[model samples]
Target: MSTPKPATEATIRANRAVRDALPFDDTTDIENADRGLIVRATGQILTDEGDVAWDFDRWSFLDGEAPDTVNPSLWRQSQLVSKAGIYQVADGIYQARGFDLSVQSYIRGEKGWIVVDPSISVEPTKRGYDLVCEHVEDLPVTAVIHTHSHIDHYGGVRALVTDEAVASGDVRIIAPVDFLEESVSENVMLGNAMARRKAYMYGEIVGYGPDRAVGAGLGQVTSAGTVTLIPPTDIISETGTELTVDGVRIVFQHTPGAEAPAELCFYLPDHKALCGAEIVTHTMHNLYTLRGAKIRDSLIWSKHLHEMLQLFGDAEVLFSSHHWPTWGNAELRDLIASQRDTYRYLHDETVRLANKGLTPVEIGEQVNLPDALAQKFSSRGYYGSTNHNVKSTYVYYLGWFDANPANLHPLEPTDSAPRYVEYMGGADAVLERARDDFEKGNYRWVAEVLNHVIFADPENTAARELQADTFEQLGYQAENGTWRNFYLTGAMELRDGIRKQHVLVTASADSVRAMSVSMFLDYIAMRLKAPEAVGLSAKFAVVLPDIDERYVLELGNGVLNHHPGTADDVEATLTFDRSVLDGVVLGTTDIAEAVERGDVSVEGDAHTVRSFVQLLEKFEFWFDIVTP
Candidate 1:
């Protein structure tokens, strides 16, 4: 494998100019980040197996100024989130930062502590909780509040509270309505595909270094540990719902569809601290996350910010799930309003441009942030940039269509590439021309033209090498961390190909068990091979005796449909535990073994059962990307 290249002179010039463009001399964010005195981790956070879960020591290179290879603005943002310790945001509120992508907060109640949004995994949150006990107070947790449905906010729940504790009413698990459905079903439904995309989005394999992995705009990195989830006991549905748990008066503002599908914000009346719940972070949050999930509602997100200010404008301190807290009412409100207006601007301008017959890509190129917003460090595109957000906003209203006949119904890349290459004087001519463009600091165009040759003939080693080099330079110049990660990771893959070891863990036993029977069936139906199942007709009456529910699975004309209640004249009647099907999907328990052991009992047409199983496709987890 070839070594990574140094930043080109063009990249160096671009990075140098970032210092002058942004107010790097101002130390307000630096001052605010280091406001509270606390002990940094300064060592490895090791699990029981002596394996390191999080290593601040590895990322210690972030302690100083930005290098020429990195975007100065992003480096500054990374430094703020890289600080690890227990910080006292207010009198009774404390936060554990830098353990993972998301931070966990501890609110001291009259009885014990109420933990908010634990980090992504067990070891990190456990480390965070231990820090709370050692540094803040040694109090048993009274409650665990999940501010949103994202796993990063609530996945490490078992670390703070157990099932017995929650069951016995010793601890209360609180969250927004439909939290379980949102967190488990949606994430697990597309687990494999999203896991692959996640690798590129975060550049997880592209670990910490001076030239790489400088924080993802949200935080330093995600933790590699066990992810677990527990259902919520208390659900907040409507806005302005007040709950006094252990003598702490908290007002919950339900912000569904703002960031995550199910999310909420809470304000402490006594402490005057408002938890934004990933709604407003230190940087511009993603309206359209590159991991290929649903598009977030920027209008609703801005409205929620407006509502937060109206409800908690007097908040002395404002903290979010990611990044550090903002102190003082003025500063906190300004941050909220700035982020709010940023989205509003994206929404309004995109729609305005579309009405004038402009498309998403065209509008994206034209939209510009006002000097006031562009100058603010918080409003910079360290995570979410105006360019992509404009496209997201336009698609939110007008969809992906650009209204041009040439754009609509275009040929797929694979089919069109050879034709494009032929028209451009073949592979050699394109590569020769692209090399000249690359030398001229025109990497964007070089990458575009070189891709046609790669797609036309993937065996073209010359094309792959040039494209990889182009992608590396683009990554070096990117200010947005996700964009940089995607570019750099793609470049690495082009050079060395995909390595399967770093796959993200998207589903677990806890999350799978939380899914409804219907939700699981829905995913199974999606996995049916339409080509294999064409002209096939079968029906299975699935009786889950443990859950005491009956479901009908009907297959016809290449479509698998699930219906509730009994179906007349079914091909076979099957009775088994839901666990059996889950095991089959997760590759834990074989269908044949379950049948042999009498775990699954078939009433009639056993041959149909075998045939139906054959039709269900096992998804390929390591499907190709950056290639056909």
Candidate 2:
């Protein structure tokens, strides 16, 4: 129960100027609401103990006009997305939005319903499915379509239908090429760090308020529950791929390295609808997400948008994995065209500036969209701002090196902060100057200067308080939800210290089971304690009887390598079912206990397995971020 600081006069005036500049009177978004009508609306969906998994009413502040602390444009978008429940997108297509981070669509087919992008978790997906069932006839799901590799797009598959049903050939799971590989390995490698940053990016640690978490631009917030993944039975490998599930016809268009590493859009010929998935959402997407991943290819993203215009321009209605649907051929086309131009403009202009010998920071400060692209509600920076996107573009093409020898190898933050403080005439002098800047409404500069003081001497209470106050002002002014969350979360950590609570990384047991053997090996490699494994040289053979897979594991020079094959000369050979292996990896059961329970068999020597296990370090989820 921390109280947020009130917005200053400067911040209020800035927000008002933003309000006056935008087309607040534009009613097209409201008018577009007519395309779909909500069938049912509820506040929250609870588990057996009355724990809330999905709460649509948390964002009720958006019902009125934007507050002084929030961007008016973002408020409008939040209001639009806050409308929860099942909606009819078209004759055959229905959508369930506001239940999770992404929408779940149901297309009525000849035999049953075809579900698209079943959201992030089991509880919300099941709730959405029940709502769909209430509106339409009770129909079995014939097919499930996953548009991309992101967890929000495909994590809730098991909630819709069982794996048993999919295995029995009663239902089909469809996704783009490399979907399983991308889905399993995408977050697993950098999962701990990414999950920590994701908590800040999504405002999961912050409470909801006018000054705190309001909306995530894409949705209210990510739902917390069991995340499950069912591997796709049919992979859409190429553009113009056609599939007819039940009676509905779909034309898939692959658009990788756009919004996601593996993504596709589908055009419905019968319903005259296009499922643009995450590629074409209401807000401008991240070329580089704040939660840390490889920078996306903006050039390829723009190209895909143009391709979508060419492939599905005739469609009269459009629905995305997030946000509401857009109707009318002319309107849908305009929306797509505007989004296309936004990315193209960002990419081309960023490159142009870079070629002119400007650094990424300079380019970010210099580049501004033309009024044409800027005025479009769909192209607004409520999710991804131009400042960061410009840097992402530069890094995607040129990488982190900027051809500056001085910056090629710079001192780390901790090493440089004390030197910076000394050069600025010590922490007291730096704090005095930062306070002057803070008073002049130069909060950004204040944050920059005071950060050095805080890092140089973390026990300086005055510097910490000043830095937190500066970040509060910056958070109040941010239009992008993630930016606001990051700033505010940083401020919260500064004031109250890092939270010790555990954050869930994986969503469900199904996702754990769906992991490939290679992915498991990668996870183990990350956990290997370098100091402990320094002089250890060991070899082992792992046999998974259930999946009929064998791997030879070698450990040397503080590194572990796993390759497909059986090593009969290994020091130890372990045989177990894949499920038992999964249980050990996921910490559901101990390896020694499993061996005692006859779930795992050890041949040759059991001491090697114990020695290897002892060298692995388990990561603590709640690691410090803002502070050292």
Candidate 3:
């Protein structure tokens, strides 16, 4: 284990300044913390070999006073979120926190319990469910409500209830409209890239310490286990949708394109509690997540927060998928209002700056939360920083193009770096200048210049060391956990080179099984090597007798198209169960082997099918980032 460098004087002063500015005397958070009495606690969720997945002990540093290496405001928030266990939210409502990236809520009904957002993986979800059963009466899960399409919310469905129970109508699996499609598809297309980025975003690869991985600002960290998904039996499509599960009345408020592409907030009218989902977390949620996804609409996100306040203002308590519940009608309303203002301000101010001819970087530098929103802990940028959110806001409206023709078609990094280094008097000269900037605490500029030097000549060990040191300083000062992790991870990669580890790029077995044939085809289309498939044309018909769906696939002009119904005029016709295709896609079974085993039937030419399969490019999960 390597000991991290101590915080610099500048970083220590900055942390102290933040601590001095915040209202540390406020006891509201403490009061709210006390309300949720713990029923059970497990600090670590381990695998069969005792390998830790999600460890609360990693954040035990939060128990003490803030160290000079950590931002005090973030440390305070970490301490609050570090409280992990099953806790009573209300008379009939309970929640399991610290089990995963998201919380699992259990609403006690007349006969059974309604499970809401069952965490990220099977092991933690099962443990949480068992804890709930121990505290409350052991009852079958009557219904499972997935508030949004995010994996952390609904990926653990199989642990609490079986697909057979849902299929047989013995249990209800409820979710937002398009939940099944969005949940599976969101992470599939660019999943390998996202999974790699997620390691940095969640600090999964980084060790836990005060100077390392403290907390994700949402939860401790993501739980690693078998991620599962069960298709929803009930879809809440429209706003004002009402459902009663085991005599508990619930009203759904659809907030799609707010936090997620498919998301909803629900009000338990009988209990006077509102489940805000991920839409309204305790910390400022991301408008554009660091792990690369579609840019979220900040305007629409703000609008939905206002909508939640308007629709469920009367509710006395508010609970979200990540954090502890807020009690009292006044406090809940205030929390919603603050979060609403945070997004709205980011949106309006960013556009205001962009209209004045400012670029994304310029806007990011200029925008800051108003004093009212900034003062509140709920609106602080613990997860999503104001700098990135402002840039995301600019991108949401104008996009990557800054309208500057100079940047319209820039040279690739490799092509551009050599020239940049030459212009800056070669690699040594650039490093000398960067070292000066590093000494002056101009880490950002040092990083920018050193990047060109590294790309120009990767063997420049001095430039790499200086750049890594600069990143360490920046990481030490970052209040946002993701930002801190990204910097640290980049530095580690620069110093030690890329760590060879097998990252989980593919979706879980259950999630793959739930994917429709059309969805699977879409994934295949994405993986097609355009260069290999160029000018090559082929047509194939796929018949899944089990699902009773037939699709005609056409590959031509570097594009793969699929449509419902089969055609007689085709190169080949393949018939098989959906599971066989799933196995092939997941790389568990070879297509030729399945065909040889007679599991897959081919009525026409098989060479064309093999050719098409050969054209698909398998993604390398550990592709380098922050380097050439």
Candidate 4:
């Protein structure tokens, strides 16, 4: 409940770098220019229930102490993202802002439109479609283009194209060649872990407000709306594969290495417009997304941008998935070039430092953007900062070892915590010193010291409270909304432990149903408690009635080894389509009921399959995390 001490030299230096990396002026100007544009584009001015600022305000980070928790930098970002309604980026192109991420659609030559990157939710994507229709002549949607393989970018496919339309072949869904594969890998393969990490990354447990929900800096926020994924009808395979849909010529330039593994930016020849997809956004996207992934290749990312520059150098209008569009060829060129150089600088410099045998931390300290690139507004880090990107570049090439043998076999958390406390004289001495430092406003140091104390004894409320206070003050000082949200959220978690009851709908049945049998079995493997499943050897062959396939799973020594083809000697054979499995997972239909209802049919040893299912642990969707 006490504020931490002053910022340390390192903290101050990092903040300065963060400021230099992402200047706030760009957002200010964009907000001013697009203010009226957003308001006018929305046909129904429903109560600003859809404001990004309202949904992700930072006030909730402060909780009860609303005034003190407000961070100026976060407030500014929220103001820009929350400035209300849809916006007109260009003639025939309108975007629904603040609803969820930013949905932008382009009108084709005929009395039809092509929706580019629908909002995260069905309701918002529908709203965006309606907003465009309200302004322009209402027309049939000819195509839905998914720029990349992110949930927010393509989750709203259903809103634009109904099931009937898709089934009837009236609507064409276009995307990169490996879009579906990449989407599954990123969002589903490790979905549970990613979902958990995303909760922390977006501060999902904390209520939305000025002090709490500034966002991950990509956009206003992610919508947990109906997520529907229909496989792409048209896939752009070649580099310059052009698609002429509804009289609009779209030249797709695939950028696989950068951003998502399967992402492409397209050039509109007719309009001289370039849709950068999620590659070169208004803000610096994460090379190492906090939600977790393989560290992105900054070098490859920069190279892709360089290629885009040559491909769309004369593009007069530049638009992205998140933020306002850039008008004029001059600004477009400048923005693209600057962002390209930003990544190049991080990549080249990080490698330079790494080649010199500097460790990741050491490289982080030394790596910085040149003054020219750092000063550019677009080069600034809003979504992804230079510091983290530098670390990412380092890790991507060198791995986490850092070439230090001493660090190779470092003490684990449990062993190190007590040693740290003892080395610092004692728990009381460390707490006293940290408290004194806190009074001096050295919040970073206070948090660091108290973190050791808590690790020493997690039950120590005083240490936890002090550390939480330290995090709050640091959060209050952050310029980047993500940093502020992360710090403040950390403080809240420390103070109130976890709040699992605040669970958001992570994956719907639609998403789960799309999962391949291999993915499902992988998830089951992950869910198995090693200790509980230990010493139990079980083999079962699961056959799908609807789909012509059977999977053999061997559970032995707490490891679930899968043989997709089949195992003749397997003890049990369970048969069902993907939907039946989904029904069981969603708790809509119990296994017994499913069998009785003919949704699921079991042949061979049913008891073995039942035993395996019983041994599988189901995670509580809404556990009381804040409670001790």
Per-model TM-score versus the true fold: 0.98, 0.96, 0.96, 0.88
The residue-level lDDT of candidate 1 at 118 comes to 86
Please give, for residues 1-628, the per-residue lDDT of candidate 4 as tens digits: 2223344554455455554444555554454437437344322322234423224233234322123344334444555555545566666666666667664656565648888887666766776677667755578788889888778877777878876887788888888888877776676555666777666667666656554656656675666556677888899877899988777788999888789888888988888888888877666678898767888998888898899988889888888877667788888888888888888888888888888888878877787678787666456566688778888888888788887899999987668988999999989999899988977878777877787788788888888878877786777566555666677667777776676643334465666766777877786787677887787787888887678877888988988988678877878777788777776555565666666666667777776666666666666543322222
Candidate 2 stretches with Cα past 4 Å from truth are 501-504, 589-609
Q: Considering TM-score, which of the candidate structures 2 and 3 is the better prediction for this target?
A: 3
TM-score of 1: 0.98
Reference-based lDDT, each prediction: 0.86, 0.84, 0.84, 0.70
Summarize candidate 2's per-residue lDDT along 378-404 as a digit string, tens digits: 888878888999999999989888889
Clashing residue pairs found in predicted model 3: none
Best by TM-score: 1
For model 4 the local lDDT of residue 525 reads 80
Provide the RMSD of all predictions against the true structure, rounded to 1 decimal: 1.5, 2.0, 1.8, 4.4
Question: What overall lDDT, based on C-alpha atoms, would model 2 receive against the true structure?
Answer: 0.84
- Candidate 4 has an lDDT of 0.70
lDDT of 1 at 106: 89
Residue by residue across 1-628, what tens digits does model 1's lDDT show?
Answer: 4577898888888888888888888888888888774667767776676666777777778767788778888888888888888888889998898888998998999999999998888899998899889987899999999998988988788898999999999999999999999998667888888888888888876655766667788987777777889989999999999999877999999999978999999999999999999989878888888877888888999999999999999999998899889999899999999999998888888888999998888888899999889999888888888998889888888788888999889999999999999999999999999998888889989988988899899889999999999998888888899988888888878888877764447687788888888888887788788888886798889999988999899888988788789987898998998888778656687676677678899999988787776677767776777766
